[model samples]
Target: MAANPWFSWTYVVENADTLWEHTVQHAVLTVEAVAIATVIAVPLGILVSRIRWLAGIVIGTAAVLYTVPSLALFAILAPLLGIGRTPVLIGLVAYALLVILRNTVAGLDAVDPAVLDAARGLGYGPGRVLVHVSLPNALPSVVAGLRLATVSTVAMVTVGVVVGYGGLGQLMFQGFRNNFYRAEIMAATLACVLLAVVLDVAIWAGGRALTPWRERRRA
Candidate 1:
């Protein structure tokens, strides 16, 4: 009798414990990278938008950094940071910068001129107008950028397996080594995809909640 060569429920059940751990590790790495990138990129994006000439330089630099292949970037970073999570995290953050920064700039720039004029006419200072008027209007674009960054980060985290730090990637690698353990490979792949979808949806929901006025207008 031939044995099952495809995905196996038995293997998944047996390995449930380790799989859960790897999933958590993957989520943590992705979330932390995106969070750090957002913190740095949002303020830089706002400053660049106001400065005009600096906009091209800043966005271009980030685009170049993002253009570097994931493996090549990891290889360059590995020696400096050593084999571990640090290199992976830094690489993910670098990749995320362009998307988040671009969206932030677009969002801020899209704020209606009349809205700002009204705020200023009502005695609102520049700082207050930026916080109260600009930031709120820009939330949609910022959130869209965040959604892209989070999904991209999740996919990129799999590449960290080369450095022995990829959470789900490690499992997939093991499956490959074990003579094409289809079950293991499929399980890990599905988990990563699911994580990305969940993150994207969560960001979308949060954005809608924060900007309830848009929802109200739709009704």
Candidate 2:
């Protein structure tokens, strides 16, 4: 009876449905949180670039939020939100905001002042300059930030188990609580690693595709 405590086909075979559900939930949580963060952060980043004074305040707030414990966030939100995925979603988004925001700011700031002047000389207004020049130049940095935030969020989703909506985290945590069931824990852990790798790769490829000129310049 070649039994491995860490993993077993029997466990996977029996829990296939549950595992699939958990994996989907994990992906959903990651996508929703990151997508929401990107939508909020990018525009805010653009605004901040234009309004220098707002940069410190907004980034500082997001930084503070990022430092808060996930469990504490769940606890704080549980009363008003009631429970489950909502709190988790908010927490993940908060966690992701700083990374994306910082990257956006950095990307924009890194753009050449000469380029902005050139756009202005060409009779481009601020909006047109931003849309045509600054953003495209800064896109690679923004893409890198997205990749980092995404990978971080994938790992952070496990913390949502406290609110009963952690996706693969639920399974991973449960296995430990249930007398350290190795196979269950291993499966969930591996699934999370796989999810993170897949998302990171996809984002990287997409970024590369979008920023092909960057490659040409480097070469």
Candidate 3:
């Protein structure tokens, strides 16, 4: 039987097992990284917002981390993490800080000063103002950060294959290695892209659900 071209469904279907495995691995690692990034970044963001001068330093440092090539980052960390999900998760969390940190800063800064003043006028302390006033106002931007982080995390998981993490990139690389050539490569690439898109849409919907105030403004 003649082998189909890369674009053909039959050609891709043949590699379905490998492709599915990689997809699952990629999704799992992404979720883990995003969860950790949110936990770390949100609190750091809040702290930085109060510090004025320090916000620039902290955010600039995170932005520098974002610019590092994922492959290179993984390569450097691979020795320490020793070829597994650990290196991949570390790199993903680093990448996420740029988006999450920026959005958090922007969201917190966007809160109405008048509203904050009113909260303080009502005898609310710094803690109450932050919890009830600032956080709710910033939820939209925080959600935006999550959306960006999720998509970036999904795309970057391909680099995990370098560390033997076996994400979808593993299927793509495997196909290339075995001379299965076109079909497996195309299928794996398409699957990764589809996974990112689905994650993006899901996060966006969740954001809308969680921040109805933003929706009301649009309406």
- Number of the top lDDT candidate: 1
All models: lDDT?
0.93, 0.92, 0.87
- Ranked by lDDT from best down, the candidates are 1, 2, 3
Worst 10 residues of 3 by lDDT: 1-10
Predict model 2's lDDT versus the native: 0.92
lDDT of 1: 0.93
User: TM-score for model 1?
Assistant: 0.97
Clash count (model 1, backbone only): 0
Candidate of highest TM-score: 1
Q: TM-score of every model?
A: 0.97, 0.95, 0.92
Q: Write the per-residue lDDT of candidate 2 for residues 1-219, one digit (tens) a residue.
A: 245389877899999999999999999899999999999999999989889999899999999999998889888988879779999999999999999999998999999999999999999998899999999999988998999999999999998888788999999999999888888999999999999999999999998998889899999
Candidate 2 wrongly placed segments (more than 4 Å): 1-4
Task: Assess the local accuracy of residue 130 in candidate 2 as a C-alpha lDDT between 0 and 100.
Answer: 91
| Residue-level lDDT tens digits of model 1 in 102-146 | 999999999999999999999999899989999999999999999
Considering lDDT, which of the candidate structures 1 and 2 is the better prediction for this target? 1
Provide the clashing-pair count of each candidate structure.
0, 0, 0
